[model samples]
Target: MGSATVLTSSWFCVLAVLAVLGDAFLPFLPSGTLVVLAVLKTKETADAPFLLGLAVACASFLGDVLLLSLARRGAPFLRRRLARSPKTAASVRRVQRALENRTNRAAATVVIVARFVPGGRTVLDLAMGHLPERSRRFLHWSAVSAAVWAGYIVTLGWLNSHWFNTTWLSLAVSCAAATAISAAVARLVRRSRQLSVVAQLDEPVEAVEAA
Candidate 1:
């Protein structure tokens, strides 16, 4: 068999397994890069594996949205535990301020766009959990954002499949690299958002003391 055929078959199997198992069992699977690589490989592989990409994307989108919904329903339980830890409360407060701002609609837009931004989804999900119970606006924006994210990643993967060139070693390395990159991005965004909130939180306190 030609190398491309072997590569194509192997990628199809791997993508299928990841779709079925990875998100639930392995948090670090780099599903985004896997999709990207799968699409990239389709240039020379078997029959443009776009269906696999779509399935994975839809699964991921559903998982994210479901998790967010669960978090929202379970907020009171979370808040009790979170409220006990000063650090947790502080983080929650930051997220709350961001979500409750006069430009909150804008913040929801960020949350939605962040879903496609590699590392932004997890943090945004957590932040969404802490928004006021009555804030349906955040939920609407989040669902729209999540849908956009799913379509964008799947489309990118389909378009870029020709670049994936599915070697086992290459796939392994790409997954690792994507995970690292996304984690680093998430950490930085969280820190920046936290700092911005801290600054905002201190402002009113400072104003009150001055008065």
Candidate 2:
């Protein structure tokens, strides 16, 4: 209720929003880092409810929506900025194939996990837009992805808070964990691209052998 608490929450909410929005296009940004920081700050204030996670999740969802809107308009500036290799393009096909199913479960899983994978979310979102899923379908999946991603990041910070009383130490550890995950994701994306190329190379050989 104090002015100090009000000021802190206000600034944190704004930062969280900005970070999420930035991450939608620019995967390298530390939006997850900012969300963890906000969680730590929220813990420091007793009166505030446990609304930090929900707020961050909502911000993340909105960011994806913004990108989706732009993409629908034929402005694929961000997607174009991403690496255009065989694997990255394959990644797009993977998403399209995932969404091709009538059921939403596979598509939902890809969307949610892509948030954790560095550079994956942008690729998936663009795929969804380009593949031209109904706006309603994309929004529904986006909500699910954002909620899961934000909750995971928020939980990491919250758990760390209990372990280290020092705010700086806790924030550093959480951020480090987030960074490690991102690195792993980047590696995974690379591996996926490699596999896709292998698969493509094998297809013609298999057809020749059969014929």
Q: Per-residue alpha-carbon lDDT of model 2 for 87-135, expressed as tens digits?
A: 6556556656656753555455556556666666666666676766566
Best lDDT among the predictions, by candidate number: 2
TM-score of 1: 0.54
Our tally of clashes for model 1 stands at: 6
Per-residue C-alpha lDDT of model 1 across residues 1-211, encoded as one tens digit per residue: 5887767757664674364233422334556666655655554545545555546655655655554565578656444554554554454456565656637555654655455344344444545665656246655665576456445554655543334555554555555655565455445544665334322222111000000
lDDT (Cα atoms) of all candidates against the true structure: 0.50, 0.66
Which residue pairs overlap in candidate 2's backbone?
none
Give residue 20's lDDT in candidate 1 (0 to 100). Answer: 29
After superposing candidate 2 on the true structure, give the runs of residues whose Cα lies further than 4 Å from its correct spot: 1-6, 47-49, 76-94, 97-103, 182-211
Residue 10's lDDT within candidate 1 is: 70
Q: Whole-model lDDT for model 1 versus the true structure?
A: 0.50
* Alpha-carbon shift of residue 63 in model 1 (angstroms): 2.0
The clash count of every prediction, one per candidate, is 6, 0
